[model samples]
Target chain A: MDTGSSPKERVVTDQDAQNITRVEELAYELKISQVMTREIRSLTPDMNMGDVLDIFRSQRVSGAPVLVNGELAGILSIEDIIRALRAVDLASPVSKYMSSQVMTIHDYDPVIEALKVFVKSNYGRLPVVDENNKLVGIITKGDITRGLLNALQHVYHEEEVIRYRASHLFEDIISDRTSLILRYRIKHGDFTHGGNASANIKRALLRLGANPQIARRCGIAIYEAEMNLIIHTNNGGTIRVEIEPHQISLEAYDDGPGIPNIQLAMQPGYSTASEEVREKGFGAGMGLVNIKRCVDDMRLESSTISGTNLRLKIFLREKDAFADVSQQGKETKK
Target chain B: MKIVELVKLVNGTVLVQGDRQDRDIKGGFGADLMSDVLASIQPDAVLLTGLCNPQVVRTAQVADVAAIVFVRGKNPPIETIRLADQEGIPLISSPYGMFELAGRLYKAGLPSFEKSVDPDCSCE
Candidate 1:
């Protein structure tokens, strides 16, 4: 796996990162046995080189493992055949053309190990053997490429199916007014999970067929409110989002220790967060301001005894609407 | 500018290389406040912050930030790296301070992603 250069030393571009990461992961996870060709095309050591050329041409294989009584002995490649041709020894025995220093790979070893061996040894193929050293199969670079492509295609199909199902949620249901409500309970001072709810809401909106701009607006607004709950509440709070075809309503409310001055609290750079909270790069008094910027409607109600409640709404334009309102009206009439 | 080029400009080390390293950065936003980042940053912009925590990655995810650069060569915790990787947001650490990195990026033709706050808006 060590390619004489650490990851930090490599100049990784954004495109390379996305591509290499997936291929790298697949290489480490896939086993040699899983991607190896199980059928053996073995060549006996005593076979004539002329016969070997006939087998290679018919099988369309560049190489094969040389075996004696089903026991691994050596590998004969196209290069060796070329050498035999150059020497005018087509009738020579297979052992004369085969390379006895065969590099074999374990059946259970990760495909990445084979990749490393290939890079280091510049071998075109390797014989696969089980733990008992019995020849099980043969693996080529082409086999690994095909295996990775199959795995990637499988994942792509699954994700597309899920997206199709989720995007058609409103269309598949019959209701007078269809709305999906998502609720999340935020823990106070839990900085680690602060934006989790917002992330989920954004993902849900995207899955539900909302456009990227709309999902982003909702994400930013909800994120600010969620963070406020985590940073300023006595017992944390709950964030509830009711998503309709035309509008999205988001509400975050806490129990106690409410804001004393609503106007001041709404002001940018006005925060009552403790010194400790400020050290963590939050409590900058911009959460409410940011939420207001992202939402079309914003309402804040609070008291020292009753805590605070913030509600936000964004009305989707016709082009950005998640579902057809006219279709819903017809369904309601029926 | 390409993120790899930007990284080279600041002599930064990539902690988590996200899926899109070749993504062209439209602009840059330098802020430690997550809310400011959420409010001002436009999509495809690189977020440069002094804060090295998981929330920064969360904030980037919400804002659709192209990447995050930690100034002063500060490496975030493992959890932060994991979150950034999962979200497909690249994370880099620079040996320079926030001001220097911002200036260098700005000099390198990266525009600012910040939207100026409207003074008369009552939403605040």
Candidate 2:
């Protein structure tokens, strides 16, 4: 998988790499207790189907767990209600309509395990139980997705701070010279602005007369590094870029919570990113690998206590610059 | 193209008309999975799908989809139509399947949803 080949020549182009990394990350092993909704909307088995429909409408939920004497008995969903509306009287007790054999999950069970249940059974929500099969909470697809949205909101907030710093700190540090240096503070969980630093780096590279290919490679490399910080690390980090006449180098150093197994993290399908991050298109476990493909040289130093530091280097030369301009000229002539 | 023109292109019936049928759609996406729509669709792109459920409307709302076109003559449930009406999203239904509708729209010069540009960007 680590063979040296151009990205375009490889079978796995970036656009269709989903099949290569179809496995779930180990990080989604969070217990349902951490993410489940405890304020459950429940119903009694004795309630009439009409009243149950009213409850569902007023509560804005399509389903609720039915209880008998404060214990889990069955699950009542909109599908069941729809079936009941067709087969039974509207005034019939919910016990007659509700699904009596409920598939349950323990609060301590991993969320991925619950996800498996959702896939297999096609149930919208599952009643969360404890050691005694007592309903403590309920986990739904909405709950999991809402958690992802909440995490994304955190990323947005970090982007605000980074934007502020870019306007204020970045302006004061730059000088008009043959060689330039720029620094950006990257925040963990800052998915919203992960690409900004790399984009800025690419712009600066282009302005400094670097070839499009070299600039694009540097951009892809740093983008991957920035994403690594946002997805993997709890503590945010900083990106330092040095652009000289012949070469460009970028260094990213985070604070702590480094990779436990760098070897596994480097694997294409191995990722620590939560399921939420994967859905948003950031954590395919391909970032580091792509970075490696883009840069001429790369180094990674990581530890659980000291955190991870990544360095990438790309060379520039007159020949590459001439080649790009000549290529553009030939295309223009055509 | 205008929404009215799009309706004609796909031989669609507008179930609930929005305020802006004259509005030009930049591109279109077709998918039945609400999650895929939520993750990938750009704002204001028309969503073509066969799954007619309340969640489809809800996903369209969350993703800021311009309008929904139910393919293969699948009319949305009353619950879904109500949600779409509440969200101010136009709902259309067509007898044509997803692929046929997409091809018609493509042939009519509408961009593929994934390949469309961000209007906010300066690039033309």
Candidate 3:
């Protein structure tokens, strides 16, 4: 149309030129942090979970940072709140259940890096920390969306972008009868004690009459998470297991350095373990991969600044519902 | 052998209602790890373990094992026994260690047939 109607070329006015320059500046400056809204209100570790719930309702923040002696001690996320309300007795203090090791960030970290943390952790929000590890501000999933909006318009690693959402995809068989919630602190490099938390979950599921399949899925996911801590994080962290009637959800966390290249870590046979772990017949680096294969829904989120926090949700299949599915063979015996 | 027959073999004292001995038994496996047993076991089989842990009995209950015989004369924890009793799985005590007891059963035609690995087994 310009070739026919216009004599030469329409000039970009001064205002349009200014607009283009502004866009360029914003394009360069819009890291993930640009979309992040800073949230600073938090709860002390000593506060009751009830207070945390109230804060969630009153402030409308997805989660709040928990402090101890004015230092970042833990986090109370919506998932934590959901687990507590569903499983824990309301009267209990947060100290009995609050997540101690948490994912955090420095305000200066590029927004792209922060997105990596959220992607690895599956947590909508992460705490911002100062050099002294004190709570400064907070970042949320909203920040991620805004950052992506400002990113270069071209699709970068479209397939690699983690997009699976549990609630959005399939309504997991959510039955509280088999569901339970257990929170515990993990110690470092204690492989012998690694399976304890998962064992406790299996026991609870049995007591709650969880279907064998659901229970087994829960066991596998939880066991992998426990072993991840022992092998990767010399200092163990924390795990919260939620047993729904049809699904078992495990949230395993550690304050260890978050995975920088989750894409590489998720690849089969990927491992960062030392020689000692390989000798123990462990750390083939199939833990998360196996967890994914066994579970119907798998989620992971992490960042380099804070440690890794993972959430795995596995639904019960029909096979585990049967009491003894393994007894059948090519030649049946009795 | 059936649970009733296994009970006879072990010379066990039936502390709970052993009526479920009528339950079908297609095979038998002996192990201690709940996940291991749960991962490979089938229902109606006789389970032999010396773990004495509550999780052992829970595993038996979940896997639908018809009976559990504690080897090495070991006794399952009280909670485990209680759970077995509730689930109607027979619980027994054997003075023989797992290797001795399993060997005897194998020799008596209860062979240690390797279970086929489930390619999609969630409990790796």
Q: Which residue pairs come into collision in candidate 1?
A: A14-B20, A14-B21, A14-B22, A15-B22, A266-B124
Superior candidate under DockQ, 2 versus 3: 3
Error of 2 at B41 (Å): 17
Candidate 3 structure quality by residue, lDDT tens digits, A1-334: 1112213233433322322222233434564345556557878867777877888889887787777778788887777777778986656777667778787887666665666676686777888776776666888867665565545342323312322222112223322133346797877777545566776676566555555556656666677677677778747889987654345678888886788888898876688878776554456666776677566777788887788989887755544331222323211444
Candidate 2's residue-wise lDDT over A16-96, tens digit each? 221111012221545788778999989998899999889888989989999888998999999978987897688899898
Model 3, span B28-49: residue lDDT tens: 7886544445445655667777
Q: Per-candidate RMSD vs. true structure?
A: 5.2, 19.7, 29.5
Model 1 agreement with the true structure over A298-322: per-residue lDDT tens digits: 9999999889999999998878887
lDDT score of residue A310 within candidate 2: 92
Which scores greater on TM-score, model 1 or model 2?
A: 1
Query: What does the interface RMSD come to for each candidate?
Result: 5.0, 17.6, 26.7
Write down the TM-score of model 3's second chain: 0.81
Where in model 3 is the C-alpha error above 4 Å? A1-212, A219-248, A256-293, A297-308, A315-334, B13-22, B32-35, B58-64, B76-89, B103-114, B118-124
TM-score of candidate 2 versus the correct structure, residues matched by position:
0.37
The whole-model lDDT of each prediction reads 0.86, 0.70, 0.63
